[model samples]
Target: MNTLQRRNAIKDELQNQKLISAKKLALKYGVSRQTIVGDIALLRAQGQPIISTVSGYKYQEAGTAYHGVVVCQHTIEQTREELEAIISLGGEVVDVLIDHSVYGQIVGTLGLANQADINDFMSRVKNVNHNLLASLTNGIHLHNISCSDEKVFNSIQQRLDDLHFLYHD
Candidate 1:
């Protein structure tokens, strides 16, 4: 009804579901999309554990997840294989990082936790016609992966090695 009520409702809606788009929430709240975006920003400032993904925003649970950085070099054609090896072993590829000589570090937030997420991400990459960060460095990049245990991390490393994607450096 009011701004506070609408904000609270938006929070409740996000809590009760997996994800919701700002446009959809704006339509439901009879407000502009920018208004909903502002509400989300304010809610985040107030410390909501909301993560914005391509599909929408979702509440994320903080847990004792094991995180490790996997450095690899691969062609654009092997992108799916690299992501699949990590995701299949219960690793969520949080982000991709590339170090450049002049510009320093460039990062891309992937948030890829499953095969479906990987698929969607790759599709968007194709649709957008953006270059993969690795291309800038001739296929060398690092992926920060979060998993449930060291075992999964090891498996991911071994799988990447088997795929010949693991960069020695």
Candidate 2:
């Protein structure tokens, strides 16, 4: 099969399965890792909504349900406040995503659910000489948020809206 065929097949597999790794696709398509990367780029350029997480590539299709992405902007000091609001609303702040001119979407999984978790995460970031995802973009970042119910989700949204931290643009 050709590169285009291989890329299409990979996309189909991802849409059916939850995740797929580059190595698996490379082997299946009898191509190199670089070729797989190029194919992924091609697929993305064609407007395929794929998320490259630490586990693997995930395909987002229409009608397929997902939690949500909430874009918010705030000063670095407000990080804790934002996290607190989400946690208080019973939502999980899954990961932080920032757009990088070079690396595309830079995502870091915080997996934080409460104030103590946030404190530990902040400490780690400070000690590792790394900045929060929002800090990389001057206090603008997208949070992948999830909750058990619409009520919780709405509550979090309301809290964020009240705080003037939610950015819809």
Candidate 3:
């Protein structure tokens, strides 16, 4: 198949399966690993929201089911407190999002599910001097939180508001 055909096929497979690997694509298309990489690059350049995780590549289609971003501003200490509160409410803190003057949007996923997880996370952050992606923003960050349902979402939002962590505009 041609490069375009191979690229389209790979994208279609990823859309159906949710994950794909470079080796698999290379084998299926009988192309070099470099070719596969180029194809993936082309697909990405065309605006496919393909995320490369440790597992493999995942396509996040528009309107796909997931939690939304909640922009919040707080002091660094308040940021830590707010994160702990959200996890306590049984919501997963998916990521910390920030906007950089030069780099546009920056997001770092923090998959902490409980207090122990939070402790480990905070420990890592401290060890790194809290210099992670959003840490550069000095507590002004966005959290992409996920809960089982809207009730849980509302509850978490209310708690954030109570703590004066939610940013209202």
Error of 2 at 71 (Å): 0.2
1-169: candidate 1 lDDT, tens digit per residue = 9999998999999999977889899899899999999999999999998877766777875673789998999999899889988988888888899999989999887778888888888998899998899999999999988888898889989999999999996
Q: What's the CA RMSD of model 2 in angstroms?
A: 6.7
The lowest-lDDT stretch of 10 consecutive residues in candidate 1 is 55-64
Judging by lDDT, tell me the better candidate of 1 and 2: 1
Give the total clashing residue pairs for model 3. 0
| Backbone collisions counted per model | 0, 0, 0
User: Is 1 or 3 the stronger prediction by TM-score?
Assistant: 1
When sorted by lDDT, best at the front, the candidate numbers are 1, 2, 3
True-structure lDDT of candidate 3: 0.74
Backbone steric clashes in candidate 1, count: 0
Global lDDT scores for all candidate models: 0.88, 0.78, 0.74
Flag the better candidate by TM-score, 1 or 2: 1
- lDDT-wise, the better of 1 and 3 is 1
Hey, what RMSD does candidate 3 come out at? 5.8
Residue-wise C-alpha lDDT for candidate 3, range 1-169, written one tens digit per residue: 7777888898888899855668877887888878877887889999887765323566754542447567787876565698788988878776678999889988775655567667766777677685656556655788888777677788888999899888876
TM-score for each candidate, following the candidate numbering: 0.86, 0.58, 0.59
